[model samples]
Target chain A: MSRPPYEPPAQSLTGQIVDALLVLAMVVVTLYLPLLLKLSGAGVTKAVQAAPTWESLGQNAVMAAQWEKLGFDPAKAAEIIGSRFDYSFSWGALALTALVIVGYFVVMLRWSDREYRDVIAERFGDDRPPRRR
Target chain B: MTDITPQNLAGVAAPAAEPVARRVALKRVLGPAHVWGLGVGIVLVGEFMGWNFAVGKGGAIAALTACWLAGILYTCVAMIDSEITSTVAAAGGQYAQAKHIIGPLAAFNVGLYLVMAYTMLEVSNAIVTGDLIEAFTHNMGLVGEVDKRAFMVLTIVFLAWLNYRGVLATLTLNLVITAIAFAAIVTLFLYVRPWAPGETLKHGDLLTGLPYGGLGILAAMHFGLWFYLGIEGTTQAAEEVRSPARALPLGTLTGVMTLLIAATITWYVGTGLMPWEYLGQAVTPLYDAARLTGSAPLEVFLFFGTLFATIASANGCINDASRAWFAMGRDRYMPVWFGAVHPRYHTPFRSIVFFVPIAILFAVSTPLDQTITLSILSGLLGYTLMALSVVIFRRKWPLGTIDRGYVHPLHPLPAILLLALCAVTYVAVFLGYGSQLLAMMAFFIVASLWFALHRYKYVRRGDQFTMRWPKPNGY
Candidate 1:
């Protein structure tokens, strides 16, 4: 059998404009919300501050002195040097994580299975074998 | 079922006597060893440097736990990837699988993930190469300050040139250098002589309880990814392999096993020689361990090992990342201009050259850890999608509907386990790099929107499902 011709779905200019605007809004919210609420943690800040000295050059004194040589603020280097990992565990975080995982698995399976069956039916007639146990 | 040939599977006509620009395909010359090299070459660099960061996060014991946990996660990844890629037998690896198994939007995102992950990794490797050279020159008391940027650019240029010339030569070079790097690790393990009395390793003095506790072990899982980050990259060469059925799975499984052994030895030697505090933060833990041995010859061998591992990683990154971009281009997900293969070389010349400056730019400008985090996050997203895609693949194309190169044991279980592990790793990343995580999500979301509104029109969507197969189940 010969291949079938395909036509792309219609996309309106207004719809495209709306999508662009929505994407912009999402990017803004996802990036700025944490900083706006001060929910951002020591992770990235500590990484930037600590990496040049602590990661590249060993020894706290040498790292601090390198910062001094570069004419950066001494307090910033000191804070970075003293940084430590937060070992506390939150049960709420764990619960939410579990919720997201289960929710995603269920949603993906349902949607993808539905969409896949539709694709097969469209491409290759509606004949299907019986389900196996 | 009808027998499948590359021409029939790809649904393309054979090339004419003279090379035709539009019809050229990637050369199929690779074997199991090249596949193994591509997988392991991309990841062995992790053993040299970034894995040590796990020690910093949770101490030695926590790091070891993270290693085992991440190993299980990647084993699931390898099995799932081998099965899917062996059947798909196309460039773009997981991207191609997503296109055929799921849909276009997923394919686009998976392709982007592959490109971003490998490109960022290439940048990191280049920067490490330059830094290693500068440090070497300084230690040798060279006459002048060595500029690392020049070496970084040169590394990218040389590798890109090699890739542009041919696939066989590029991966053959990778196989050689990757083996040497692996041998270096074994040599170090033998030199330390852990089995002999009064061995060099001082594990009794050095082993410590998890300094950060159990939560720290969870946190360390993110860095633990460094142990085998790019092994899934083996499948990127699926289309080029001589026999995708036998070679892909063999190469991928063996690659993971190699990493597991290498990771264990690296941890043992490192923690045995250095204090947990120092081992955790040391830039080159293995090299430093060699320094502790006070063997100049051993130190120099490891220095070359670190250097070669970094180079091999960058080389493989260029290969995988370009294949992804080229595959996307072939489908017009990106511009068709990048789809062109060099008529004689049979390489994706445009895609290979396209990423050269981008890698160099990021290498010079971006902070090392930031790039590393973004690469890992991109990889995690790809794995999550892979887990979901495999389930969809099995349900739609159940066992008897079509031929499969390999079938993963206990279907659905690996998928579910992969999903769970990916979720835990996502949480692990969020606990530490929450801002970067959010930022990466935003970037991909925007890119998806762009593809939907702007790029989708150019893609001949129906042509993407070219692979000949029996009707999917439940049709």
Candidate 2:
């Protein structure tokens, strides 16, 4: 059973608006998301100890207890597992990040396509009514 | 609309009087979406595994840089390949394209090399995925571990069955698997939002060391290529695509772009969470980072992502390898039974069936890194030929003379650059592989011997398949 030849439906105003918004969202995500993630100081970093002694660091009994369970000197453990951060962002990192974001969006758009359905329907040559969204 | 009649297909092998009749046929059910899915899905394992090996070779920074370099190189190949696929639109991917464009011997070599490459890749994926499943099960505290070899065989059989069902089922499964795997990456990216505030960036300096310097960077080249390694496989679906001219370029480029993003994020996030040395040695580095986060849910998410990615990649490889086998068989370069398609499923079922035991044998025997190198070796040979084919075909057809949908932009430059890059990478692969290079050489010799035997058989029969290719006018 052969179906009607595919006729690409007219783009509704809402559909067109959604498409425009998707494009806009993609642009924003690609250009700014990397900088935002970078500025947020969320990356691998070296340890920094604020406390002068194990007692000072382990004022909280829970912290002292946890360090003891791991079988390390409280002072040494404090230094080893201290508050860590990385705020540095290089130009190269930023460029790579942006490239990734853009690539993600491009792939996403292609992966979720109606054209595959159209092609399959045509090849199967079915006469079923148009699928309801 | 493009014609589906066998008479219109320039090089499809069948009896001369009944060119359209065959034991089985491919159903043309793919469009741009499915094409993109196949392109990205087949190669997604690179994102999930293997790439971190580059970190050991050249440190994180240099490895990342190498990836970008390879990305640009593949972008060129993808564009030129898209143009050729659209114009030729044959079933055997690069093999079919090369058959008409570069002649029969070249086609045989290209097709055989591609089959080897995809089979190696699929075998590697099966083994790795089996190990991953066991590890993930342990991580999740699931009971009773299965033997890795048994699991590997099961993975190959399952994916082969999916492919044997038909093209639509295979592509549909690919789309789902790729989507889930990609979603997991997105989840990781969102999780790794803020840079840690106080830790020293020791790895930044690690990038400059390059371990053994130039040799180390060269050693890292194949792992870098992993980022965008199998995007060219998209062309294998040309016979099934509704409009290869329109879909090939859109799908291939889009797929390449998607991989670029996945590779960059996977690298940045994985390295950012842990030191390069630690990340490089771990079996699944990304999942290791999730564990470091100490978030159980995040760990589970990344684990599922790894699992799905492996499935998608292996499944796609099975589809690609079988098609190459089918093409070779149809051309009578191999046993005719391998060319038989299923009557109802419209698939190259016999080829799929034949491929399984061989893939299982490979998966059970080879170690992971060696399997990876073998795949890369065959891939480099195919890539070299494909880039060369771009130049030869362009010169022979000269754009206007042929009915083509996509014309490569900045014609000849991409082809030239691809040739040079592939030459450099080939040297890099050779320098890196040491003893494994000898094994690859041995494999090449074996392939050559097989080709010689095949040629002899064809000559003796006097009903040579190679002689029948109708020469295009003005070439």
Candidate 3:
């Protein structure tokens, strides 16, 4: 049997123009929408202000100088550092998260088992032979 | 074998020359190592920089918890992707799988997701590369004020040219740099000697309880995605791999394992060296940790590590994004002109070149965090779709119906877990980035509408099914 010749669909100039404009609009929205939404607030200044200084660097000026030489702001590099984890527990949120995990697992197991068995039965008849493996 | 050339065939009539056009395909020269390179190269940059943001949101313990949770999510992703990609064996990765299992609109959306995710990541990488160089020159007192845009444009151009040349050379380069970046993380881990405790790492003083309680861990899952963001990209090279069935699963599974190890070491080293507050907000936490050691050689090693990881990531992004865009073009989901494979180089040259300007433009103008966030959201959406697609795939073409190189154990469990994890991750992201999440959804909805209304006319529906599989069961 002979196959038909392959010819791509013809696109009109107006159609092409519309595609180009549509693509351009998508690009614009992708690039600028996040910025307009104020998602870029995690800027450098906030990072510098929020960063805590290492206690070891405070006693050693030479090390601190090296850190500054590496482009970190020296003024922002002064503080006593310690473990900030205070074990403040949010029991409600924690319990909720745990419940979601356990509940989803049970639900998925039941649903998936039924669906998988159907597939198995469909592919191989109910009187299928035993596996060679 | 008989040699029946024109000269050898004395009386036999020559076969009639067909009028059909010749089909050009991507070269199949990649091995498992190249597959590993492509997967790891795109992700090792997370070890260098971004993952630490999780610590800022949820503290050290929370960050670690998020790391494990995200690990599970990507583990399911790797398994599901490996199984389906090994069967489909096409260039668009999830997009290709979606097209085969699901319908056109779903496939179209998945294609857009892949393109957007990798392209945005490429832009973020280029911007980071330029910023790293600028910071380096300034620290050395060699240059006063550097124009980062020049370096950003140069990085994109160089990578695009590399991608335009050939797949083998580009991935071989990725393998070398990715290995070095991975080694740097290992070296830092060894240098700290966590086993010896107080000699270097002060974990006793540094290891604290969860700062913001349990909810903080959920929040941290959003940034924890950085640890293994683009690992699923290994499947994007499916069409180019020499042995898609064996190589795809092997590379992807191993790649995920490697990321899990690296993420753990990165978290341990980072939290031990500095306070969680500082580590969370750090632009380059690993480099900052190296400097805290007061060792100049270690500092230099980490500096170069960060630079090389960034470059390698951008390189891998170019390869994956171009492949997805090229596949879409081949199916006429977009203009067919981008479907052209280079006759000499045997690459998606037009698609490779198409992204250079887009990457450069966004690299210079877009905020780094915004681009990263968008990329992550797109990737999460793709993962969610992948979970659904795999279930559909198994039901439509059950076991033994088609050739599967690697069948993931516990059918449908991975798919289900992937969905659950995706839902949790979405909630995590929404807690912090609700507005950006909504806006991105709007953007994809609009793009989907455009695909349905205008783009479908250009796509020849029947011709898009280029695979050699039999008609799907019950279809």
Residue clash pairs of candidate 1: none
lDDT of 3: 0.74
All candidates' lDDT scores?
0.76, 0.66, 0.74
Tens digits of per-residue lDDT for model 2, A30-83: 322332343211123445565555555532443343334334455556544343
- Cα lDDT tens digits, model 1, B1-475, are 1222445343323231111123446777899999999999999999988788788777899899989999999999999999998888888999889887987777888898899899888988888888878876765568998999898889889999998998898899999999999988999999999896246776765576877778788888888998999999999998888899899999999999999999999988888776565566556667677767778799888889988999999999999999998999777777677777887888999889878866776677655656677788789989999998898788877786667889899888888998888988888877666656667765776677677667777665345665676655554
Off by over 4 Å in 2: A1-133, B1-7, B10-24, B194-208, B459-475
RMSD of each: 7.1, 17.9, 8.8
lDDT of 1 at B161: 94
**Model 3 regions lying over 4 Å from their true place:** A1-9, A36-133, B1-22
What ordering of candidates by TM-score runs from best to worst?
1, 3, 2
Residues B77-194, candidate 2: write the lDDT tens digits: 8988888887777778888776656555556667777787888889878988888877777767778966788889999999998888888988998899899989988887777663
lDDT of 2: 0.66
Decoy 1 TM-score against native: 0.82
Worst 10 residues of 1 chain B by lDDT: B12-21
Model with the higher DockQ, candidate 1 or 2: 1
Fnat, model by model in order, equals: 0.17, 0.00, 0.09
